[model samples]
Target: MHIPGFDTTTIGVADGIELTTAMGGTGSPVVLLHGFPQTHLMWRHVAPILAERHTVICPDLRGYGASSKPPATGPDTYAKRTMAADITALADVLGLGRFALVGHDRGAHVAFRAGLDFPDRIDRLGILDIVPTLDTWNVLHGVDAAVAFHLYLMAQPPGLPERMIAASADEFFGHFLDIWSASPAAIPPDVRAEYLRACRDAVPSIVADYRATATVDIDHDRADLAAGRRLTMPVTVLQQDWGSALGFDAAAVWRPWAPDLHHSLTRAGHFMAEEAPADTAAAILDLLDR
Candidate 1:
């Protein structure tokens, strides 16, 4: 289905990975990445608004939505570096040598790695509502652990989380879609169904994605920490002030990783794109200007 706001196209890259992309308008290329349990359609509200002024390219990251979901090639194939490689490959396939990158949740994890691995190609980076992989793993315990049950659950020995989640896909995904935001009415019924369907279809890949976090991703982050490699581009972060819950200075933590950081406490929950697209789009546009 065509995501409401933008024109859609498909690009066939290596390994026969056919990526579904929503492209529109023109100027400097701005690549938008969506979080987990969602698709490129997550940017439906924001992309076309930016598309009027920039070339907005929003693609379904591998194993999500209409994107190719090849069988896992081992633990390594699901790593953030491998996923980031697909983004670079997409840019190459489209002849975009340089572009701005924005990603949220799972996509943000890939974006951070992409910025570090291909700093020369990315002009600016916007990571929505996430910290570095190592930081997240290092920080979670007790109540914080409870909030992130998916992390530990998916890291288990396969098939289990996928089967359990597939049982009541709507309830599993829709629970967050309803509670994560300050407003419940933000996402309409059809959009909510689409998100749930995507989540159901991508369950295995999603499990593999989170599992990589506990293994290969941690190694990568620890290596970067050891090397003192911080983000070189100007960075903007939008997150809920989890001080009342997670009990840490969210912005202060990001400072060491992002030299120039723009941190804001948004009213929405995890699905900030759908919950607060106006604010989300505005934040993205503000970063684009910066």
Candidate 2:
């Protein structure tokens, strides 16, 4: 599952946590974070393209893929604040004073937190297919919320969610891989198998990651919102047109957090980096230029 030109290694980013990272190219650094139910391999297509112009570092988020899966000892354990810190620590460990960051899905939450929490260290920010954490909760309601059933499932109490998901890990994780992509061919069979295998082995940590979003992550976002904290760097958001179907203006939702924003809609599925790597990489490169 390694990207052809990338070198993979384990780098310790926190106490007892080491991230499995793939790094390639030799220029300004850009770290790409993967979303739910997938690993750094999710960026296989897009990373190579970006690597041509920047040092592309793709890591398996702590709880997913080949990274450390510490038990969720407390709500803070998997909070986006904590997860975001891991990225900064990783950069620090790699001697990067500042770098551009781009994230998709759950990783987008982490990237958003990083942009807010460590503005000086982030040169530019790119978020794929997600609204801000607070905005996400604010926008989903009534029947429209049903589209995000997995959010509720994982947001439940610890034991129940862990047990429920573990009982049918593949089916649970595979559901997103199946339904979220408009172009199934984008994820070949081998890649799909790898994603499922990773998710299957990391159900508890994955659920813990999501559970933190419902609790501590929200608290952090609300505090930031109250403080009027915004990403100080240039930000680009590429998303499928879910706002129209779900009854909200996507650009409007992102504008407050990202004052210097470039928001565009993609015809590709939620997995835009895979389904539309050239377009995704182009947007990321454009963000770097800004």
**Residue 109, model 1, lDDT:** 94
* lDDT per residue (tens digit) for residues 1-290 in model 2: 79989999999998899999999998999999999878999899889888888999999998999999999999998999999999999999999999999999999999999999999999999999999888888999899999999889889998998998899888888899999999999999999999999999899899999898888889998899899899999999999999999999999999988889999999999999999999999999999988
- Return the TM-score for candidate 2, rounded to 2 decimals: 0.99
TM per model? 0.95, 0.99
| Backbone Cα, N, C clashes tallied per candidate | 0, 0
Which candidate has the top score in lDDT?
2
lDDT of each residue in 1-290, candidate 1, tens digit only: 56566788888766878788888879999999988778888887888788878988999988888888877778877799988888988999989998999999999999999998889888889989888898897678786678788788888877888888778777888877766667767677777788888888887887888889988999998899899998899899998877447777888888998988898889787778877888998998998999
Clashing pairs in 1: none
Which runs in model 2 stand beyond 4 Å of their true positions? none
- Highest TM-score model number: 2
Residue 270 in model 1: shift from native, Å? 2.1
